[model samples]
Target: MPLYENRINALNTIEIDQNLLKEVQVGNQSVAKTLVDKIIENKATKIAIEGWYGVDFKKIFNLIKEEAEKHNLTVTGKSSAGLYKSSEEIAQYSAKYLTDDPSFGWVNSDGHLRDLLNPKALQELRDLKSESDLLVVYGPGVAVEELSDLYDLVIYADYTMQPMLWQMWDGELIPFGSDEPDKNYFWKQYYYNDFYLLYRQKQYAYTKTDFYIDAVVPEELKLMSFKAYEAMIDEMVKYPIKQVKIMQPGPWGAYRYRDLWDIKGLECNAWNELAGIELSILIDIGLEKPINILTQNIMQRPLELVGEYVHKTFPELFPLQVWLDDGYFPEPVPWERSSMPIHNHPSTQYVQRHFNEPLGRYETYYIVESYKGSSTWMGYKEDADLEEWERLCRDSDNLKVIPNWEDFIKRWDTNVGDLFLIPPGTTHGHGGNQMILEMDTGPSIAGTEYSFFTYDFARNTWDDNTKTMTAKQMKMHLEHSFDNQKWIREGRVRSHHRPRPITQAGDGKYRYDQYETIDEMPFHIERIFMEEEAPGDTQGKFMQIVTLTEGERVTIVSKRDPRLRTTIDRLQACVIPASFGEHTYYNESGRHAMVVILRLKKG
Candidate 1:
């Protein structure tokens, strides 16, 4: 039996027919009005409509009310505004619990949206049933347990923000630049807390909803049955999927990605964060432009996409992230030019306890392009004074801490095809003049970009929003970094990170090389070097994410179904679903190709 034999046997790999999708209605105001009328005919005296956070349900509610009044039923509109606590109350609690202080422990605000919903408002909702023949209540948290009995019928109205290639989605980007003080404040408190709140509300809406509307495309109501959404996810899981990539500009960002991708009007660094998790599916409806749909909206059946074990282990989310880091600096330049801030990620225990995440971050860097003077920083000196290191990091913001970084921090010269393992709490960063593929492991729910910086020496670096690490944040870093820190000699660092041969294939022409493996890591990294062309198989074990690291291009051919093929260009990545039992990597260009593969650990 193969590694994932049991999983494959347990999984129902049924591909939902596309024709069945037509059963779900897709239209505009007319369709919504029809749904409202259906509820009214069912003898519903009062109805409550809920939506995901940040969604305005007023239009949907008004349309329903207009139709209700036309039917000679007395209609009443009751906004959920009265349920919200005063802004002062929210602000005061936000200040107390949402700061960077590690001692200020809590992932969300106290007495938040659901907790603060006014009891008096619930009473009013109950009273409306006696006074009016029809009542419409709409807003976030309307689906909470407290409001469950107040409605005769409950409906969910949700919208997905469409994504554009090389652009930030509507809610992810921090507008008004990162240098703004308010932006910093928002990220520390409001930004993260709001996401948690939204995530909770969305989870509640899943079980409490009677009907759902995919209001993603404004002026259109893509009405889908709850089962139709499940069918959609089942169909989506049968094929290879790609998420739209976004380009980001930062203080340390370079222009290589901009020029490579032919992106106009931007000459800065480019990186794609949370590519697999924060997703959008590209659907081709035979139109000039394909629609971009958020994957979260269609994730009604999680098991279909992630398999049985993964669904059980990480039921709420996808656990991996692939990020591309493109940096540029001329050859023979100072190392400081390309270096990122000296920082470390939190440990699994620390993040899980504090942020309610399943795991902390562990990343590995695969070098794609390495210049003459390319290098990276990792680990700490063997004899480094612990107190001195802490003092320097704590006082770095005031410029009172300056030390020969290369002496205390282990710096390694780099070349193409090199991989560096950065375990959590490891102080590490790569230099400029290199393009690196960052393969990281994250928990299902929390997107992983947690870094605590000790120092950054580049000029004007602090101007970037992310680089502005406040004193309070630095203190938090100090407390968290102590236990996770590893001080080892230069030789041990190399021994730990150096890639070793794993296996040979096809008369030893094809080879597999493993980067490194930490205990209990959820994923592993390897490089596949194909001499001319070679067959690759997943063996029903784990899903593999492959990136063409070298050569012009490579095609992935389905071993069982030859017609199923995907071509990946140089530096492009694709996912091989776990259900794709066997495949082959062919160098259609008739040249040797090197592909980097990241896969989940085999049980």
Candidate 2:
């Protein structure tokens, strides 16, 4: 196929109107508004997912697979890599591999996206773009910063700045000459990018290099570069975004493919932070071209306007907090993972031993108390970490405290038997004994310096050059829970389960909003079953908990006394938020079969 033909084909497939985009009305909010709105108007959806993990990346992989099979745009390029024009992308890469690190063989630090993009993977992404029309580019950061430039990169700098691609997106250049990342942008791998994508395998700053983490660099170019990494993360952390809204904007017109009921605003800040800092670098590199102007304008647009428009267009953008993943498990060793090799990290060691793999399975449960008012509490101001264990040998005031079951179960509807994966989408509450399932946003293991680390049984030092274990690696290993990467910006959501809705029935003397004589919220339920196998009554004047499973029942014994209130148990099924009362399930009746109780709030 011809060059323009391919470009036009790619553009046409995503249905983006390349009909000479509107130029900005200088110094006008309306122009910015129009630009932002235009992206949404075209039904554009800007999504960010760190696709490093093989399994998680499979989600997009599958989407591309299905789309490519249908689109037939699966043609191999000139290099069998990609024929993507230079003008099409900002950069490319050349990978270098080491004998020791074989899992991810090629590590590219500079030049060309093709050098890093395996032909097959790009084909899959392109195929998806054909059917979906969503321009999916691997980020530019990977190529620049010692990792695979798998996706197109977009960084967010602090000053009103942006890169070439973004300048083109907005049609302007950055006015302020804030050329580089400052000290505010640098981070110790000790923090571990909040341990999301790097998984539970390694620590934040434990790169097999010669620099001590705390070794100071006089404000030099290298120092500025180090800070640039920090800057990238900071930007993504604060940019307001809604995950659910990322896929859809505007109305369904008459019909929509999926329901957007669970409108959430929770953000996976990992991408946000990374993008913020990365955008800074791009703006720095793209100072001269036409793109420099446009990208700057796009990034400079304030967050208030963007947030407002999104709220106006999508109802779910407000009060949204269903962030599904956060890969934070700070470690000191590159390969020391949560569940992989269980250690005596004092606090979490017991839990790890109990649920350690082969013998235990990861359990799933619902989070009951994540909501604070309307929005979810995303900021981990109260970070949980394993403290230094004084000794089992001496019990003065120094026994390291283990994370409690109460902490784990209080937020969600959880069971005791559950195990959790670490690094990405991990909750500190669920930081129990299970092989740490390490999966983080970026590949740098230096992001996991927060929340927890592997406890060293005997003191040892970590090597500066080897990024490996030494004596310090041993001292830092005991009690092993230093969670400094809290600022990594990856959104780690605490999760739980929910029961179906319970409302008032007709002719039961109780009307939903107006007829109920009494009201309640939570309850302890006990289920009396005729047989464990019996299909409990879905019909009747019985208070019960129902699952889509095989059985149903409810039973609660109350400790509180009911004054003159007549208990309403005559209807086929009626719900009392709390099962009668605390410690008592007395209904003036005995042993009601198929009875289950629950706690709920109705709007």
Candidate 3:
């Protein structure tokens, strides 16, 4: 029997304070009103408000002052006087000290404002202290150690970090275009490192601020007190959640899948990556302003979210990351397109020794869509020549060298129902002209693509202008590829990599197709085909990552709470929390539906 089978309220073990949690709301009008009420209660004669860019502290302060005056209290508002400058200003500094990229003005990777606050600004803050009854210092610089002595209470109002494809610039969601100001600035700062810096800053802020609130929900600023906010995380961990999709351009990207999902105006190359699975979840607490937070952050409390047993086994992170890799080939190809870069991830020992990763990547591709001549590259010929392959890998470092891959690499003619397991150290790539739903272990913490690229078919990535920037990836690829090679014959490969159907529940309503995702990897994947509908229970054992691979729409209804149901469309994914005990999936579209489910191995 599952350990949690009788522990229905496993989450209730963690204590939380509702009143304290409500103090620090996410950014909302209530924040201003709350401050006003506080000032009135204290009967303070003076008050000052301070914060960072994007937030009009001056305007918000004025509104708070207006409310305070009704109670005959005098209030003053001043924006933080510190290293508050625009990206353009930071660009000028970068040009002087960092990169020569003309577009370097858009880089925010270096959090320099903390170190560059002017002396005059500090004096102005000191001056405000003598004139106000209450000083509310808030903004990006408020948490800086240098400005520690300037405020009575520091409320950090921040938005969720915008995805790389889009950013909140001056209150507008702007695409990272190849223009002067918006130029592909990310490449200049170095893609993964910049993201790491942002992650570090976010993690660091919790220690710096007296309180914090998520200001992401537009027009609905809910200030959740830091204690309450952190405590409220229990609510998020125990609920079924969906990750907002993040789409980016890839050389093999096609618009058919993107259009099908109503994701417009993207360079639809690839949907997600094996490593870069930094996903966000919308915290729907039956509130008007739902909070959006990173799944990594929630899973940091794995015991609360995934259960104590799973947490002890895999601490601080969710083990799985599933995404779609869509590729298209027009009838008459304009440019030569080949399969995904022939590559393989590092072994568990190799990843731990080299990259300090908790687990090595292991992925399974379930084919959802296939076109003419669609295939996948897996394994290698029994007699493949490594001496010749090394010569080609070295020679093609700077030149276009095409080799007869079929003579050396094994191939599999794929169809819509095919499933392929891609274990670490296995050479595999999705052949063009097919859309594959890839379910894999989460990426390394460093967010670096662990799959070492062996051959690119002499092709370039979708972003040609950033070729100079991407050239850096090749050096890492060359270093990791040589020593991890594993070649296999047809018979050996067939025994391990082939897909097969598993026994389904005898309800006669659904069938299950399972795959052994790499030998001894502690996880397995199966696809459930709902002819009409199907009912099953987690048995309080494990969490399941369910993706609606093929169906117009399907509703997952909780037998415990029918009102707490969610509908997922085709090609979308959602997590079924382990505590969501008994549930039933209904084919709301009145047709056959396919749901690919991924779960950890039972003890």
lDDT of 3 by residue, 214-247 (tens): 5444455566556666766765555556666655
Best by lDDT: 1
Candidate 3 runs further than 4 Å off: 1-31, 39-131, 134-136, 139-154, 164-212, 217-222, 225-232, 272-277, 284-289, 332-338, 445-448, 464-476, 488-491
> lDDT per prediction?
0.60, 0.22, 0.58
lDDT of 3: 0.58
Candidate 2 on 69-177: residue-level lDDT in tens?
Answer: 3443231111111322332221221112211221112221122323333445444543443333333322211122222233232212111112222232333321111
* Candidate ordering by lDDT (highest first): 1, 3, 2
Task: Give candidate 2's error at residue 571 in angstroms.
Answer: 39
Please identify which of the two predictions, 2 or 3, would achieve the higher lDDT against the true structure. 3
RMSD of 3: 8.4
TM-score of 3: 0.74
CA RMSD per model (angstroms): 7.4, 23.5, 8.4
